[model samples]
Target: MPSTPEVNFFQEYWIDAWQRSILTLDVLRERGNAYVERSARTAPHVLSFAFEVVRDGRTLPRPVNYALVRIVPPQGTAIDSAKPPFVVVDPRAGHGPGIGGMKQESEVGVAVAAGHACYFIGFLSQPVPGQTIEDVCAAEAAFIEEVAGRHREAQGKPVIVANCQAGWQIMMMAAIRPDIVGPILLAGSPLSYWAGVRGRNPMRYLGGMLGGTWLTALAGDMGNGTFDGANLVANFESLNPANTYWEKPYQLYSKVDTEASRFLDFETWWGHPVLLNAGEMQWIADNLFVGNKLTSGEIRTSSGVRVDLRNIRSPIIVLCSWGDNITPPQQALGWITDLYGHEDEIVANGQTIVYTLHQTIGHLGIFVSGKIASREHAEFASCMEMIDLVPPGLYEAVIEEVNEGTERPDLVHGKYLMTLEARTLDNIRALGVNSDEDNQRFATVARVSEINQGLYRTIVQPAVQASASDRSAEMLREFHPNRLRFASFSDQNPLMGPVKGLAEQVRANRQPVSPDNPLLSLERAASAWISTCWEGYRQVRDAATEAIFLGTYGSPLLQSMVGLGTHHAPTERRVARDLIREADEAQLRIQLQQRFEVGGLPQAVLRALVYVRMVQRSVDERSFAMLQAIRDMQPLNDRMSLPELKACLKEQFLLLRLDEERAVRAIPRLLPESEAARRAGFEALLEMLGARGALPDEAARRLARVESLFGMNAQPAKVAHA
Candidate 1:
């Protein structure tokens, strides 16, 4: 005897629930089919571009599991051969290759659209029989050399984009062979592994908690000499249980029709895990992770050349996100503290390090998010020339959208302008969560790792090796939780056989809930509740893990047992030899003392500009681009290469640092003695400084000094819009 309204409501709820169930089934069926199809492909590189294999690592003397491919842009998007080639090296941390270019709006896509010859460094799913990380690094260097050779007409060296794990490898390569790399962009990569804040960045503590690199060795051996990547993917999923277990599925269910494609696309990469060799895995864990040797300048290749960050002379652009838990901004940027004493050390070493921190993008989003690719990646690619032209210093590159009413809107074709602001070591430290106690704990972990690794090698490894066989390893890999989940829902499962047919019927007679439907709202509420539960559990578990780690490792008795003292010592900064060489020092002093009065008008203008930049300690993309434009237009055009220009700028900077008053007064003498020439030079300098419409008080004052020195009329510093 229910009322008519109640009966109607019950009927609507039932219909809505039934339709949602049908759509969920259909989505699952599609996912299963995509998984099966992806599995069958075997050598699946999920890239959108048509590519040719340029360099096969297998052909090298020491074979590796990687290859270099040249991407052929689609018709009507002809590449400018004269433009520097762009090479992207995808990370092989856990997933298969090509995530960087799977979509139209991606790293590779942005580079190709900008008319650069594009290349990709991707690896096979299975590692070659005896490949090592060093072999892979060597193979990558060879690939870069080939690309550089092919692009001889380009203005500079080939630009490289290294994502995640690949970022560290690229840095190592640049350190070993600076001649092979131009401007390097490291996205979502961890350079300083031992760097992180307390209670956050739990992954950094896992190695110490687990008793160190022995566990990594055991896992590799358990995989039959090849480490399975599914475990790594599982670890990543575990970091965000709410999204992995609940929100992801609920999102697809809510918008099953529209979200299916994106879900499948991402899962295709996430589900398809790759493999790493035992040696490669162990090397990464021991040297890079546990030893923390790369930033310390202690990692040496098999050929005996020590890989040092200071050896990398190429300009580096580090793009990290504050929201990334896998590699937090601290881990991404803390190497500056470990490697350099101050910003002056960076300049003396002749390195340009530009970092951009996104407020909320996660680790994966740094490389795959379309919005990020369109804005950050596009701006970085467009500004490579200007970035190279920037003097050696630390900078933070800021990307902002162009205002329609802004000056020189025509020059702003990409809807965004990137500005480089000078930064100090204090700024880098602000981005980090560095504590001396944490460093000591990590150092203790490193020492413990060596002891445990030795014990395992002598006692456990032989037994493990004797018992482990290819068959058993294959069985272990097949039964992994990540793999089994996919397998269970795939065509291999008998219960899924009828899903395709039923899904087709559901699609044909599809019905969806209205946004205002009470049932739909309730479903969303339930889903959110479930997600919250998972998140709560994850937080508690992470807290327990962290507490246990600190309690066990923080104990003084354990530290004493490991021969570690509790005293915290500051990390020593190693300066490059070239920075302090006698020849360079003598030559710099000579240039500084040589009367600047003998230089030409162009030289004087450039010197004055550098002086202003040094004093203000800031330069933006608009200003840098205007300077380049001006340099190209006059008697300065084709007069000096970028290196020569950079050299001149550095010399002037050093001279200004030595004697500011003398440097400022010498500007007029460097300019033509003619009053008209001095006036024109002053006007041009003002135009460059005022390109963005307003100047800071320091810049305005500096300009006044220059006008007075040149005997020009005191005029307000302003310029017409381009």
Candidate 2:
């Protein structure tokens, strides 16, 4: 063998050579073409572009015409009636709705496996003309109504899953029509719009840096009314130049022979941009992205009704990733920070909010990655009832693996069971310092965005609108810098086909780099060198950007523009003492002992159990189902209304006795006179049922018997006969 120094030098030389060759324009052309052809082939397998248009009486514009796709359950499968239906509303930010139910390994898929009836809220390539955000919300309400009608045969409310942009939209709908939806899971979404820390999230700075929403407006006018989706894709790519430029390409080139198809499929969606109406895009930037009004209780519908966060009473599960620079955990959890300001306020408001933060997963990974979808989303679907059982409060989801007779951490296909902790706002804040300065900075951005938007509409919009046409808009969409790269080289181009064929053949017989390969070793070293330089550059760039933004917009004059100097005056609304009186007259009480007993244990003993176990608050559906199962026990046969029967079963739940005397101790609490007091006590029993959660069909049927007894228009003769 050659001397060690000589061998090392030769390896380094070849690696440098390979890097230079790979970085050339020639290599990029061949690779880009290969990517497109492979994407053309694989796109069909991964994506189901087939969709049905949803029209609700209005003459919607062509651009807003959308398609609703139904996710069918498995063949020969029996669905559990207790499982709720899941409808995932995909982000219309750029790509279409299939993402929510793209494959058997997605959010929709996980829900289906857990026996949820899955449906997807997706739109077409062209939106209907004059389709405002309001129109879309109305359409969603109609869809829910249709789904509810279909599911009336089986009794369960639909659980809505909103991803990214869809999260806010679903929230707006849920706030307006809470009766239509059950529990809501807001995944990888940012609701408190103006929430983020400095340096960490630079994406929030893009609006101010680009001179606010004017550029979008100008683009919209140029599009004749529609905003091209390519712009959004470009914005996502620009976040990491190295990843966009070299790393993504090199990863494929290094594994080119194998990764060619996988790389292409992703890029096609990444490349195939969508469009939105001018009115819709502009509103998003102003109200959601910049104004940050939704979480603060300042957002309003076009009809002037205020959009209040507190009005949303459903259990909202917020899933976010710490590694997602786009919507950080801070942005995801910030709504809680903005709305309540304290944990007690959450409980007092009777809101149940649970959030989970993954240590390292990108924005897309939250939806696309199988590891995350199968484990996190699956676990969430499984524990939804348990989540519902959690008393109204703010809690941080904690997941840990169960170790059984082992010294090492147990891994089940690389997943672990999570133990959720009831947390205070201070615990969340301790994860990162949430200071007012950051809030102030975002406020300033919002103020500036408003000013800039006004100027654009007043000074520049008329000219652009007058000059714009449908043809010009189409031209702009095609020739957009982002689209140009893919369009010029796609299969549609005649010049690329032969070269693509030749490259496929080359790839067929091609050999790949291995640990023993000199070029492989050298390539790794070059990548490390490049990464270090990139990190340093990023740090410097961030520091400079912060300094510039603070100096320019952090001034007192601009701060006031953001409504910071002026505190929000509390609206004068007298508390309805009558409402309190009604509940009191309705016979509501703060009974600690009853609460304990309803939860499947005695008050003192349960508290002692909690104090001693110190594991997790045991809230399971099993015991509640057991109590429902007792309805089948001999000789308490009666049919009643479901709500009332559920209440009665709960009243009798703790009455189960090892002996006659033990059962006797609980009899008085199980029965009461005075119809309203009886109803109120029954309500407590139902609360326990809800807390205990879920029942077997036989148990459910027995419970149904109890419901039939108390059901409306019951015969007096029946009560006398009993």
Candidate 2 is scored at a TM of: 0.76
Model 1 misplacement above 4 A: 1-3, 567-599, 635-643, 672-680, 708-722
Q: Can you write out model 1's per-residue Cα lDDT over 435-487, one digit (the tens) per residue?
A: 65666677788888999999999999999988999999989988888877777
lDDT of each: 0.82, 0.62
Clashes of 2: 23
**How high is the lDDT of residue 215 in model 2?**
86
For this target, which candidate reaches the highest TM-score against the unseen true structure? 1
